[model samples]
Target: MMNRRDFLKLACFSVVGTPARSVFDRLTGKDIAGPTKEGQPKWAMVVDLKMCASKPGCRDCVDACHSIHNVPAFNNPKDEVKWVWTDSYKNIFPEQSHRFVSVEVQTRPVLILCNHCENPPCVKVCPTRATFRREDGIVMMDYHRCIGCRYCMAACPYGARSFNWKDPRPFIKKIKEDFPTRTKGVVEKCSFCEERLAKGLKPACVEACTTKALTFGDLNEPNSQVRNLLASKPNIRRKAYLGTEPKVFYLE
Candidate 1:
């Protein structure tokens, strides 16, 4: 017997032919067609590891991102909900390291978040179209449409998305009224601070960094700081060989 979710999924695929507009747009109330034209401002971020390392044990970026987004602080590893956090260099860029790599570089703490890849596999695997990429290239999730199928979580190589094991509002120390708190049985992740971008402000993490290690701007703009940094610095992306084309670049 087809369950409600199964019926919806089948109905969505049935209504839309292979090449038509996303059937889930009407069904899920969100557009799945992403980045149709050229020259639109494609958002990206650059993280300078040297500068970030200068301020060792800095949690400004992580705290700022989580507070503004209303991310829960479950404190349990099993129910962790993180928008931004840190990981060791080798863990972040396993393919970029070698035996000759300096120990300092290998174990350096690097900020981690959704890379907002140009070709996001999560969007492709989301059965309910809960996850989709915007025309500006920001991968977003509609929590309401999410059926907690966990397919997107399995598809994302970066492990950026988090599944809410329980209602998250209670765990949030203080809810940001502007952002909606997510319920149990949904997936969420960094949206590249699209809300702040819409308000002509930078991402929470970038603005909160005292060392100015994080840079955010339009990747399509030749004169943008992010573009200029990428041009002048040797940068690496997490799991780039997977062909994700991650917009977040780390200058090591």
Candidate 2:
């Protein structure tokens, strides 16, 4: 009954603390362990709203992520690009809001980033495997393989995906030689700092957060910071009932 995507998710569930590439290798019988069913780390993020709510004007996290990732800024809000940004609580969590809620908290800008869900609908809908979930549980985008169909964007419920409407060269001030810039028509989103993780570094947003509001860690490890936060404080995930099982949690 398991489809290819389901098989990948199943493999991801058993691959903790291992290289992302190993997931594919095991599928091809390249690993000594063969196909594992062990509980592996589901990478996750935690946003401490109690700390982030006060620093809405401070965009260090956004700036760090964007600059390093070569994300261009078109200036127009409707056409602007973003990897991480801020928006009102009501706008981000419309379903969780109530009329009795205070205006300040309701209107307060909160940090918004990709959830990198366990069961990503975008991955399921991608015809070209442009977006797929790695065995380590990170949803990734292969821009070179992307065909610019926008199906992934339409499939994403969080509105996390963005399609480049115009050439980004003019918008990018200083282009990083390392990160590849996407041509117009490709969809992009937050990558959960997979590159940094490969080099044994934390995410740019998490490190740039002076208030220490951002926590990134392996969910499978009970001693991890994100896991500890979830254990001690009540956390909220966007659209939990939708069954996406987002890895990012907000500590309100």
Candidate 3:
């Protein structure tokens, strides 16, 4: 006789190979058509590391993103981050070795944010349609629809998502009048400035980058500036081993 857990696993696996339409119906109580446009704008980002080293205006990008998003500013690790952050080389990518004194990767702060993968595992794992991929290839989170499960956070390899562990209203200061404030108990990540994009503007972070380290454009467009930048510059993605095929690229 099959155990209950094993039986459930088997049942789920049975549906794994089914069409995405059926999967959507089963999970979301509705069927969503796959994207219609074959070559719709697929925005990707490239961070130029050479220009990022001790860069003067680097924080401007982060500040501009936070200012526009109405993200809370609580220092407590539990209630921090929505759009941008800084991570050291060692923290972002720890060296794996048996040697006791491996030369510390010269610590340089890298701006960290959501990669918005072409194939986001977060979208697949979300039981609610709270998190979904947009037609423009941007991964968006609908805070109102979220159930605070944090499954998307666990599924993401890049640690891009943050959860609201407590009420966020108190932490916000001088809130942006136009942006909606996020409530407690939802998973949030960068949206690549979808609102701005809709207004025919670049992401605030990209616009704030004085050194032009951040580049955003349609990866599907062969002649797009971002594609051209990638072609000309050697770039890499975080956690390539996971095969996420992240839209965000980094040029070192």
Full-model lDDT for every candidate: 0.88, 0.84, 0.80
TM-score of 1: 0.86
Against the true structure, candidate 2 has what lDDT? Answer: 0.84
Index of the highest-TM-score prediction: 1
Off by over 4 Å in 1: 1-39
TM-score for all predictions?
0.86, 0.84, 0.82
* Residue-wise C-alpha lDDT for candidate 1, range 41-144, written one tens digit per residue: 89999999989999888999999999989999998899999889999988888888888999999989999999998878888778877898888999999988
Task: Give the local distance difference test score of model 3.
Answer: 0.80
Candidate 1: give the clashing pairs: none
Please write out the lDDT profile of model 2 over residues 151-206, one tens digit for every residue: 98898888888889898877897899988888888999999999999998999999
lDDT per residue (tens digit) for residues 1-252 in model 3: 999999998788777746755866656423232453786888889888667764743588888888888888888676676678777656665642233534443356677899887668888788887998877778899999999999998899888998988877778877888998888898888899999999999999999988878899998899999999999988777887776778888776
Candidate 1 displacement at residue 7 in angstroms: 44
Q: Give the RMSD in angstroms, all C-alphas superposed, for model 1.
A: 9.2
| Candidate that beats the other on lDDT, 1 or 3, i.e. the better one | 1
Off by over 4 Å in 2: 1-40
> What is candidate 2's TM-score against the reference?
0.84
